[model samples]
Target: MKKSTRILCNGALATAVIAGLSAFASGYLTGAAPWPASGLTALATANGPVAGAPSVRKTLLGSAPAQARFDRIIVRYQDAAQTRSRPASVLGAVNAAATRAGLTGSRALAGHGASVLDVQHVRRLATGADVLRLSRGLDRGETDRLLAELRADPAVKYAQPDYLKQRLDFVPDDPRFDLQWHYTHPSAGIDAPAAWDTSHGDGVVVAVLDTGYLDHADLNANIVAGYDFIHDPDVGGDGDGRDADAHDPGDWVGGNPSSFHGTHVAGTVAALTNNGVGVAGVAFAAKVQPVRVLGHGGGYTSDIADAIVWASGGHVDGVPDNADPAEVINLSLGGSGSCSQDPVTQEAIDGAVARGVTVVVAAGNDNADAGFFSPASCKGVITVGASGIDGARSWFSNYGATVAVTAPGGNATSGSDPDDRWIWSLGNAGTQAPLPSPEGDRLMGMIGTSMASPHVAGVVALMQAAATEAGRPPLTPAQVKALLRGTVKPFTVVPPASKPQGPGIVDAAAAVHAATQEIPVDQGELLSNRVAIAGQTGAAGDARLFKIVVPAGMRSLNLRSYGGSGDVSIYIAYERVATPTLFDRKSAKPGTGEAVVITQPAAGTYYLSVVGESAFSGVSVLGVYQ
Candidate 1:
């Protein structure tokens, strides 16, 4: 079946607007080393069955002030077991049950759980259950009614509308950089107007988890407070407002500041901008909370888990409610390993999400398939990959089903000139200037998707701001994700064709503008990516590629635009010439946004007409892989 295509914000909107956390590229046009030699090749065109199915169970709400309580409340529920309706009706049934018990909403919160319930509207307000806010419209007694019903319904599992949530990262938009290319991707470095028409996300917080950040002039203002999760317990911080850990402050030096990756990532999210010095970050302004988890070399998964819990209001044994709790957690580090559904990793990530904090992760830089990365492959979290200057794959960014989207990480390390590199961010001011000599200043432009993830986190902040400006309605995680995806400026050419697959480069202007589009708009879906003779019109946006799952025995096909205004003359041939192929030509009158469809006469590996038209939109669909 043909699907409607979704268009997002044009690059015009990203002209420097003020807002919160933001984050989000690729390579050149050579031969298709990663893609098929022919322009149209087959790939796993359709989305496979979703892998993980994590459930959302809420007891306490996040916005309930640091004092509300509850044991558990199911976000989504049904009454299959009870053979009846859900919690609402269950409440009525339970009230009947409660009346039988001679009590109204007879129940009590279990332990110290009352201190953690809030988050009434969760669309983009909360990630999971950390901040559980009961429906404000519902009365206290209504809880009793539902409880009575839930406890009675044998079929009813649970029922709770997901609360809204807003998550982001720390970044600095210093405007000063050795080089900066605002390639429309927020992750490449947030771009928009200097001020907002309205303040959408004023009261939200984001936790940056990466290298320990250095104290820089650009970042001093955005920080709320943070902690060091680096392994060495001996390495305590200066305890002063600064995150100077007990360890000696030095460059990657004698091998030290590797831990500061956290700090760098933080700067990219909420770095103080317009100060006339360094670079500016995606989120023009956002409250950043630093949570250091990697240090001196690398860190163990255990410390990272604890850090996640602490970032949220959840207690870690005795580490009081973190000095700064986060509404969103930024995880820009990940290993090139398969996602092991291990309890620990899963729990930690799940716990963070449970608390209404959106978790954003990096897709890794191994240049391998996405299935090879953890956390990125983890279910629910926003997994982002890196692209380059020209909006091409970074040659090294991992790709696959798990990847949600691509951003400009800038391929500083990938051999592409300025064309491929990361969004410019901030470097730290050495604690004690380099003894004024050989050391010089430690801060320098670093590269990697590691550098790009925070940009998206910052974008999330902007989205939150957009919602706030619209009034504090529930902004669910699903909705936030949808907005992010739908807002993307679809790339006509695949990411510079470095990696095998790419969601295409991100466009911050497109993303923020995407927020302005209708809520339920379709983001467009692909049926397949395989082609036989694969080809594109010698022109720019022309040529159509497709995937056709060949049923059985079939070959030779005739295809044409389904709903064309008039008889169009397009071509059907092979690409790299030299051999027999199909679908390669120009068109006389492709018709104005005419509906096009290419079908196989029978079914087999083949390619069809390549009508040179501009743009990847129009109902006209392409097919292959058959």
Candidate 2:
């Protein structure tokens, strides 16, 4: 077995009455506010007591309905109206729509000032749409009615609610090598050691769309230039709107210092490693681009959408172009709502994916179905859930079919021994500012689906780096997500009967190893007849590609692999080589009895691959078509 190179380590913006909002914010501050911590009883610091706090499980675990109210609406006018019409005329058209909806008339918003109107323009979006803030917040029904009326206008292209998104975070406790068990634990860990031998994500850039970065010795070296996208000064807490500085001035809404949430998150993605320093990060050698979107309270949907596009190297109207485009974008924040309810945010995610960026998001900390969360439920993104030391779904992790995979997000509530269950990463000791001694306050232990999302993001960086090092083109977002789901480690503990937490916990080593292997076109065997071909895969991550040409007018095509001693999976695709990540159909049942049947099959060459989910021998592959 390959050995690890370095020392071990472990470790919404939105509103609505988010159950754990206060606890999440104050719990992670300088001292213990309310959340649980290590075995140590309350340890007092300059700020206050910082340990042995009571668990907010009841408050944190329950699902809170997303705020079903909106104070703004986004609209995109038809081409001529948006580009050619006078500002007054556009305002008139919008007011006309508002009148139809039984709302008051409105005025055009100034270039850099506020306005008094029932529906006043807020700003333009990166996608060329316009945002208009209402005089007051509207209930769900009222917002829906307003949107309908706006969309009914002849000059309107589309109209959507401008919802708010909150960070999907929770406060964790304790910091030490033992507490970092999520990195190397036999059953619960991600197996980062084996992956480190192959790739430390040296050349990849991962964009963290969360609170801005706080300077920390362990993470500063791995952080690249980032941008602050928060436009509301009240939320920014930086006394200004959007600017070039991504420095976190603190996001404390109360008497405590900031939570240093982004710093903790960034550390997990790419903190400096093997430097005889604090804690090790998942993709320690990768560069983290901090894209600040969430701040005090949370952030607006429009700012987040713009950040998503800009982080992936797309153009945002006012922001400068990203010099370092991210291969992976981690969204550790979200709001309570279905993806369909927020088309603007979904559109941004869609655009980012189309640009070939692997978007990873938290399934949410709500124990309910992940499909209820924005971005988590959005299409073309890898939604992740949290797992615990026992290898079961974390108590607070959102579950459902939408979750792509699980990772160690820690469960401090597991039994009484909660000391080693939380994830330890870089953090700050100062409540509102950096301490004089950087190293003293550089470590933090935290848990949440927020933490879980970054683990997958880091793994993606490693995979992309490994593939590039192997001389392969970068994997597309779909391909990356496919590999992650296909290579997950099966859960050791059975999850709740109804809530499915994806295939299993993420296996970093398995994912990276798979990313490094590619099948050559010339190596594929051609199936000339219906005779069963016997083959074997030497070990897990090994695969055998095959090609079969189906004649025109084929009514059906069937393929199967059976009689294997160990586990194997079958993947089939038309006209292209099939791998786990790039397959049209796949069957990965236990052992090796797998089959794929296609009705009204397309007339073309079919590619089939038998992959070893574990070492397998004496596997027989047969294909039949009529």
Candidate 3:
């Protein structure tokens, strides 16, 4: 008999076995890494099994799953060395292969041209790959057959179904704008309203990865066309699988109503502001790209990863290239495990950052160390923790060395009865339990790093906009993180007091101000007898090279770097070079400092190079030689 695996549901035998085993063990709860046993239990109660279960939770509307729509496949050519310059040839090859594969009426066009293959659109990915969408819709079996035939072609690389993704927040003013204490509060908020004067994130695009969104009066104007990434119809809940439509159906699971999490996060980042209607957003002018990843039962890591790549204009097997790529990507969801250990998620993040997209993630809500959570712990990401009204850490916000900064997530510890203490944003009138309500849109309060992350993401949008307006290039992820850390408001008291919190509360005004200022690059100078210099690495991949002459009798050379906000490495070569590749000696440690000692120095002309590590920037470097 062939062994088969099925998704575990809350009422399934696997969940029953786990629950039964929980009774025999006291520390069973403690073994959960990212989530506490209570968190897992709550998740189980809200949807189903905490493990591998598809979301059975219903949203406020409690709609039935829609049928899969749009039968399309993504195909790549076999030549690995293909360049983006040859779009015509790529199209010709794909069209030819489609014809041979019996994909009747197939024709390939470049740059969104009409093709006989019903090629709805053709997107050239950053990887120099092409993604084509078929005009005809097919069932899963038919799509699989087409994909197999296309893959068998010599010119074809790989083909697969164009999987769908779910859409997945903020503060803006229509009426209850003042209720968002997380925006205007001096110590407890991100100081968004004040920063709005300098910049409102104009011309910036932020990708929100979460459950698909709803048609809200306040958010519709700001939402651009986004793709649904949900492939499984059961989990998609939108009645159909992946399509160009990014509208949120409902993700209510178990008995929980739709959280409208993506809408809430988008509002906080760039909802219409000063409209005298709802509430004020952090960056009111920024555009939001809703890439749905989570749906019923929650989303899979695989879907989430694909959304990341697509949102950043990278290629997915069957997805069209994102026309409006995001300058910043906000991820409010995460699971147990270190990002270093999870290659799939880490690679997506790295690829985004490589394309100059700043990634902001939420620390888990377990009130534990964030180092145990993924994406938050991922290198090159801006991990955010949450703070409450008292200017202290939220009781439930995760803390640890991995946290880059803290923002208002809100605290209901005082009580949820009063709306003042919680972080308020636009929401559907339906409650978590999903009740019939006459009211349409309303101000809802929530607490968690999920709520906190959008504040930072919004502020980042402001900074990026300000930088662009100043006629400066877009800031790299490393520079953004550095500026955020440099401008933070110091914590009154450490949240856990055991583990260190982030540098301080994120201050949008200060960050915008910093972005407007000019950054000076220092050039090192050589002394008469010895070479002593001080400099800084401005951004990731930045290399600061300086020339130093080994004195006549010098037999050894010592070089070192110290006192900087980010990790820096030292490289030295015997010849003048534009890059650091020709290094004779180098030192790359995992901290703010580095050192390299060369024994038998034969110096004609030695070049000292300082490079920034992943997302490492604005770190001061001091070079001393004896």
Which residue runs of candidate 3 sit more than 4 Å off their true CA positions? Answer: 1-178, 414-417, 431-439, 523-553, 559-595, 600-624
Of models 1 and 2, which has the larger TM-score? Answer: 2
**Two-way lDDT contest, 2 vs 3, winner:** 2
Ten residues in a row with the worst lDDT in model 2? 12-21
| RMSD of every prediction | 20.7, 9.7, 14.6
Order the candidates by lDDT, highest first: 2, 3, 1
Indicate the TM-score of model 1.
0.51
lDDT of 2 at 359: 92
TM-score of each: 0.51, 0.76, 0.65
Which ranges in model 2 have alpha carbons more than 4 Å from their true place?
1-65, 78-90, 105-117, 154-157, 173-177, 255-257, 414-417, 433-440, 519-626
* Candidate 2: residue 528 lDDT (0-100): 69
